[model samples]
Target chain A: MKVGILGAGQLGRMLAIAGYPLEMSFSFYDTSGSPSVGFGDILVDKGGSGAKLEEFLNKVDVVTYEFEHLPLELTQKIEKLKPLYPSSKSIEVCQNRAKEKALFTELGIPTAEYRVATSAEELAEAAAELGCPVVAKSVTEGYDGKGQAVLRDVADAEQAWSSINHDAVIVESFINFSRELSIIAARSTTGEVAFYPLAENNHHDGILRYSIAPAPKVSTELQQQAESHIKALINDLDHVGILTLELFETPEGLIANEMAPRVHNSGHWSIEGAASSQFENHLRAIAGLPLGNTAANKPTCMINIIAEKGDKEAILKLPYAHLHLYGKEERTGRKLGHVTVQADSYEELVWRVKNVATFLPGSPEFISSIS
Target chain B: MKVGILGAGQLGRMLAIAGYPLEMSFSFYDTSGSPSVGFGDILVDKGGSGAKLEEFLNKVDVVTYEFEHLPLELTQKIEKLKPLYPSSKSIEVCQNRAKEKALFTELGIPTAEYRVATSAEELAEAAAELGCPVVAKSVTEGYDGKGQAVLRDVADAEQAWSSINHDAVIVESFINFSRELSIIAARSTTGEVAFYPLAENNHHDGILRYSIAPAPKVSTELQQQAESHIKALINDLDHVGILTLELFETPEGLIANEMAPRVHNSGHWSIEGAASSQFENHLRAIAGLPLGNTAANKPTCMINIIAEKGDKEAILKLPYAHLHLYGKEERTGRKLGHVTVQADSYEELVWRVKNVATFLPGSPEFISSIS
Candidate 1:
């Protein structure tokens, strides 16, 4: 079988690697050639050129996208040519923050109070109703903590609206969650589902810095609650691929944050730590194959190799540290790759994660907080 | 760094997969267009065509071969153009049974008694010295039980010689070993060495059928003995890549039967069962990178998906079974792919191996012996 992917990034590359063994080939549509150019000998339509897009779509049995921000019109066209996983409806909900937050509230999945605003006056009204300290975010074209601003007082509403560069926004109650957690879940066309252990994630400047799998010291009830909410989302969307749901663990309880309808960065440790990797499971889910085992083989900590290429030799010399360089050019604040360290004990995992982080440039100091 | 490889079969394909994560690209020289044609877009000199040989060599930093049978002249030419791992001398020794056995005996390694014969008349004499039921095999161009014959009586010499197409034969005492075992060992340019757990192998009609990792129930002393011999061979050759030693576990001890100077079929289970796969280690050794951990993570069995393209869906459904298809056209007796099953115990590994084997065509009945 052939799978058509909308983007040719590391996620698509990893997907291709996982899917190849299962007798599946990939054709990617992207402007820049996927650095994984040599992974398979298939045509890549530059910039999703209309002529090449039609040709690419005709060759694939199924279609999917690595990045969720692909234009809805393009995906709808792909759906007409072939089946697109995660469904256009799911993408529509995920693309618009208002729609995503609205759905969560409608489903009774706990989320921070929020309201849509199309003007500075309406933003001011939303801030007044939600009280001080609100976050105003552009409803579209936002990621990596961009296109959003914090308004500490009602007087800051005008500046927040201008900072986000638009009135098409979702203004929301600020969440003072103690921790951030995410669950990597997969659902097959047959409705069979599986999930990796919850991961506690840490972000630096809106980019994921580190993710510890099985969320050390997390309560089992909290883990079950995360899985339940994730189950409801996948079922509601009738999704047939991997989905990642980020959540906030606040004093009140777990609150729905946002979700990515694709294989996630938080689950990359599964490549070496889990019985079957999230990449493999995602490929299986979309290819109509049975979902694989999602249990972790050991406690694993994945530290992102952001912006700067690390001292590979030093990182590799660290025992049990598996390095994955994305074969991408390094730019400040860009995710180049990651390193995963697996150990028998949580203490060892933490130590190795820190040791690995030390080899990479611009690694967050939070890694040294093992104490 | 780029690594040049001769013969783009599944072994080279796997080597590319392992090296890509480490930021290495590959350029292969093969007439068959390398079954892994998509691994990289670098030039592939078809049949090592003289016109393109230098062109191909100039594009690579170092050279390695997936198989040992490349003509000595071609490899000598490649050595002059680029550094080839498992040097030309090592390849010369491994390409011919006479040289290989001589080296083994010279190194004081235990091996089957043998005599190099150039004619049928000399073969009869070798039988007299080695005793009846001798095996006559071609000194070169032999693999997978091919180009060999057995003589049960002195009178059968002519038939045996004719069976192997006459001359250039090595007649040896037919080994009646209890079991077969193999060890995958790696050596870097700096002499850093590591060995994966010994694998207990089973062969059907001289083709490897299945390999059980850590060679269930093996004595630690026996494992050490095998490693010692392998260490001697690599150090003596000053080899800088992975080499595999296949031995017969006889009642007296172990006897060196044959060796491949590259990744071996028996080590495929390391992909999932070990802390680092043999393919990855081979890439690390060749790239001048630090070697990875070789410890087996779990008990595992690898079954060759030989001669038949099995029901992929059924095979994939087997829990914890990792599938690897070589993307080859299947013919009777061809190795198309393999599946490795990891489990908590030997019994469970054996059971899963059989369950997976049932989905493939022409699988052996010996898989059920675990019961």
Candidate 2:
């Protein structure tokens, strides 16, 4: 089978790696020359020539995307030529904050209190209604910490509106959650559904830094609630591939945050920790193959290597550490690679992960609070 | 780093698969159009042209071979341009049965009684001296069940000699053994050495059928003796990368049979059963990276898929089974791929492997004697 992918980034590269053993070939199309050039056979730089996109699509059996920000119009056109997993409508809903939250509300899924606004006065009204310390975000094309700001008081509403720079915006009530949790769910074309264990994530400057599988210390009841909501959302969207649902653990219950319609960074630990990896499962689901077992082999933790090129020898020498370098040039705050550590027990896993983290360039503090 | 390989069969393809994540690039040289052409960046067809050989060698940083049958003169020429792991001398010894057995005897390693013969009369004489029912093998370019024959009596000597066809042959006394076993070991450029657990192998028509890891029900003292012999051979050769030693279990102890100076088929279970795969460890040794842990992750068994392709869906549905397809056109009795089954217990591993083996094309009887 030949698979075509949009936005050939690291996710696409990992997907291609997983597909090779299954006898699947890959071609990629990206606006810029993507780093996937190393693994992919045909790279269509869409920025250089518009006609190459059609030529590339003709050679593949199915189409998919790595990044959620892919334009909906292009996705719909590609669907006409070949099957596109997760559907363009799902991406359309996820690319905009308002639409995503609205879908959650309509499905009776719990989410933070919010209101839509278009101007400075409207932002102030929404902020006043939600109380002080509210978050104002653009409806579309927003990621990381960009195109969003926290409004502490009425005096800060004007600057918050201008910082967004977009007329249409979503103002949401500030969430005070105990921890951040995520669930990765996969729905096959034949309607087979599977969910990976819940993951506890920690972020540094709005970028994911560390994730622990099975979300240590969480009750079984809480995981069941999160799985219920995710099942409802994927069924309603008629999703065909992997979908990641981010949640907030509050006093009441699990609250919905946003979702990504592709393989996620928080799930990288599965490559070494689980019986089967998320990248392989996602490819299996989209290709109409049987889904693999999602059982964990051991307690696992993953830490991202951002920007700094740490000593490779130091990381490779540590026991139970699996180092994955992206073969990318180092840039400040760029995710160059990650390391996954697995242990027979959770205590040992934490200790090994912390010891490995200290060898990193910035000496990240992902496990400081575990003690 | 870039590495060049002499043969582009499944072994070379697997080596390239393991090298990609380590930021290594590969080019292959083969007499015929290699199957690795789909995955490799360069394919030098040695049969069609001679000029491309130098051009191909110039692009690689170092050189290695997937098979030990590479021509000694060609290997010497390549050594002048780049460093070759295992050295040309080691390959020379492994390529010829007489030199290999002589080295074993010179090093005081226990092997079956053997005598070199130059003609049919010499073969008859060697058989008479060694006793009846002796086996004869060709000097070089022999593999699987080819280039070998057995002499059961004095009258059978001419037919056995004619069956071999080659004038240079090594005739040996056929000894009765309890079982067949093999071990894979690696030595780094800096003298770092690691040994994988012993594997119990079964062969049909001289081709490897199935392998069980850790050689179940064996005494630790016996394994230590085998390891000692392997260590002495590798140290004397100053070997780099991986070497596999095949042994026969007898009433006295373990006796040497043969050895491959590259990764062996019996070690395929290491891809999932061990903490690190043999292919990855070989690449690390050649690339000057640190050798990883060689401990087994669980009790494991691997079965080779030959000739016909099996039902991929049925194989993928089996729990804890990892399917690896070579993406090559199937030919009768040709190795197409392999499936490895891992489990927490030996009983469970055997049960699962047997269930999966039934789904294969040949329905091999390798696991029937486990009880």
Listed per model in order, the count of residue pairs whose N, CA or C atoms clash below 3 Å is 1, 0
Clashing pairs in 1: A31-A47
Candidate 1 residue spans exceeding 4 A from truth: A32-38, A41-51, B33-39, B42-52
Where model 2 places Cα greater than 4 Å from the true spot, the runs are A34-37, A46-49, A367-369, B46-48
Every model's TM-score: 0.96, 0.97
Task: List per-prediction Cα lDDT, in the order shown.
Answer: 0.85, 0.85
Candidate 1 residue lDDT tens string, B190-306: 789999989999888888888999898788899999999999999988888899999999998999998899999999999888877898888888777888889898898888988
> Residue A172 lDDT in model 2?
93
| Per-model DockQ against the true two-chain complex | 0.64, 0.67
Q: What is the lDDT of residue B304 in candidate 2?
A: 86
Score candidate 2 by DockQ: 0.67
Report the C-alpha lDDT of model 1 over A191-294, residue by residue, as the tens digit.
Answer: 98998899999988899998889888788898899989999999998988999999999988899999999999999999988867998898889877888888
| Root-mean-square deviation per candidate | 2.0, 1.7
**lDDT of candidate 2 over A1-371, digit per residue (tens):** 89988877778878877787788888888787655446666665657455678887887999988888877778888889899997898899889899999999999999999999999999999999999899999999887667989999977889999989997899999899999999988888988888888999988777888898977887889888988998998899999888999999999999999998889998998888776788888899899899887767888888888888587778877759888877788887888788888888888888888788878865366545554
